[model samples]
Target: MTARPPTVRERRLAGELRRLRESTTALNLEEAAEGLGWSKTKLSRIENAIRKVTAAEVQQMLALYSVTGPRLDALVRFSRTTRQRGWWDVYENSLPTDYATYMGLEAESEWLNSYTMGLVHGLMQTEDYTHHVARSILMRFSPASEVERRVAARMARQRAWTERADPTRLWTILDETALQRVIGGPEVMRAQCRRIIELTEQPNVMFQIMPLAAGGHPGVVGSFAILGFPERFTPNVVYVENMTSALYVEDEREVHTYALAFEQMAAMALSPEESVAMLERLARQ
Candidate 1:
């Protein structure tokens, strides 16, 4: 009885549909609805991604907007995936809406560019580190079981880089403080460092350390990640998180700002070989 929340695919399809209608037809909402012989509310809901659209419906709308050729075929093909459920769907009820949405996007991303100021990225975290981090922040307000659920979800998220047949390419620039701050204690940090070192050996993984000597840089403000997808229609998303909630930046200019910042930080950070040496040295200490 409740409307389903839009998945990343649905949101992409909806945005494209709205763009086409506005740019091509140049019709106002009421007029568009009248032309489609549908109630204004129905069109509104579809455009807002509150309702699922059928492939047939997509064709009809494309026809109305005078869309033809490859773009039309692509949209119709994309519409079929709008209703497909992701593995993360099972944990949706337990996870925050924004976090769940992030998981969905991460799973489908072809590559990731991450800059971390205080901790290891979730996709690269060891189970012990994940448990410690989850409990430290969540235990004050969340029940132990809920905390465990979150931990499980995080661990599952690692599959994007680990278990997949074609693993997502990951490039992370970690602040030196993140390496120095012993998360779960000496032993845990050692194991975590070892884990990171091992992952860096993989062809798809790239790790860099922004040494303390770097002094000041654009990333000094905070940490963020940019998710790039294989398809052009599904634009890159920049994810920024704080203590309680997260923000997804999709505007071209805003995402470009984050991307540029990441590139600048990457230049300031240690090279991949040097970073692995630093990890190995830390693991010993």
Candidate 2:
């Protein structure tokens, strides 16, 4: 069987464990494996997050590395926390593996910054718009049942919009053409625009339109989202989607590139208040 890709938690745990082992001058992978009585391959898998490391295993390794006191307790807690499932786990089999991981990260994120050149962002799409868009894109090859399942899963991912007491702060910059494109006919498009208008009133949401008149922009190539977690230690990630797959950029340098691009787009886009006025005007038309 193929090994499952590590979840976000597993990756984080793996990074910390690897850091701990490397920080010790006396320990090397071969020496550590011998001391733990595990093969180098097994130890490598744990460090790379190809396999889930148990709490017991974490304690054993940390102890071997001479980690103790509150630091040891914290690592042990992280091991257990990594095993806890989030709401996104239910749809793991239904969604593409990469998309499922995106949803998982989105769910855990405290803030999101997104830019889109076409279609409304999924987090802000209406049910009618979502259903129509999903059918249009997938109906040719996907079964109706499967398409519906996909649509449902997409809707569920929007929970961050309202479910949390302190809702996830979302800042999105949309290409003006996205507002002009009619995805599900006039009525559906009208409702969709209105939905976004309503969302603008929310304290945690901000939307801006990069008008066509503004001419070419960095976001012209495609769209991406930069997700920030509440935990200070977890660095931000940039997510870029393509036809059938997505790329998650975790390296500080690459994510910085996307971040700068988004800032440029935001600067070129109309202000939030002006964008709302534009949305309302378009909805009326």
Candidate 3:
């Protein structure tokens, strides 16, 4: 039988757990293992994320490591959510394992902040616009027919913005260059820009632009996002996309850095009231 696919999140958690263990003083681990009445092997598996680690055990481990402050609390909470299923599980057969994990995170996010360097966020994209983007992106691995289905799946994912009873809130920052890049030509770009204007008016959505004239910005780091949860039971995480792979960061410090950057982007970009006006102006051109 095939091994269960390791989620990008799981692999990361395991790596971090192993790093913590490797760097831990033997005496500290010994004392903690003894107090918890757990075998060293068992602790190892937990740290490796090879098996489930209960919140109680994680709490004990954190205590042993003297990991106090909000970081500890956040780690414990993240452990609890590590096992919860994400909606993208249904499309497991369609997407690559790592991309499946990304979809799950997207599905479960309570609040998502995205900055686009080249195109619009998928959540804010119209079906045609998303199709154009997905097919172009998948040109390497998939044939034309397969790409169409994948494009459909991507567009379906966007339905979360409008179809959910309680939709995930999205705050997206698009660059003026991306909008001006003319996705499907002048008519299509106008539609896309108009869609942005409409979505920005939703009570739960915010759309804004970073004018090329705004010059350099926090997003000069390229595109990234922070996915926040409504429940305190989970730690907020940052998602980063690189050329070869995507990464998830759950460390509160890292998450906050991205979150602060997002806040700055929102503040420095147009206000929501003016953002709509800005989009309207762009769509007209």
Clashes of each: 0, 0, 0
* lDDT of model 3, residue 102: 77
Sort order, lDDT high to low: 1, 2, 3
Better model by TM-score: candidate 1 vs candidate 3: 1
Q: Give the per-residue lDDT digits (tens) of candidate 3, residues 46-103.
A: 6555666667877787676666778677777776666555556667887765567777
Model 1 global lDDT (CA atoms, 0 to 1): 0.88
Clashing pairs in 2: none
How well does each candidate superpose onto the true structure, as a TM-score? 0.91, 0.85, 0.78
- Best by the lDDT measure: 1
Error (Å) of candidate 2 at residue 194 is 0.7
Please, what is the whole-model Cα lDDT of each candidate in the order they appear? Answer: 0.88, 0.85, 0.72
Give the TM-score comparing model 2 with the true structure, all chains together. Answer: 0.85
Model 1's TM-score against the true structure: 0.91
* Count: clashes, candidate 3: 0
lDDT of 3 at 283: 79
Worst 10 residues of 3 by lDDT: 1-10
In model 1, the number of clashes is 0
For candidate 3, the TM-score is 0.78
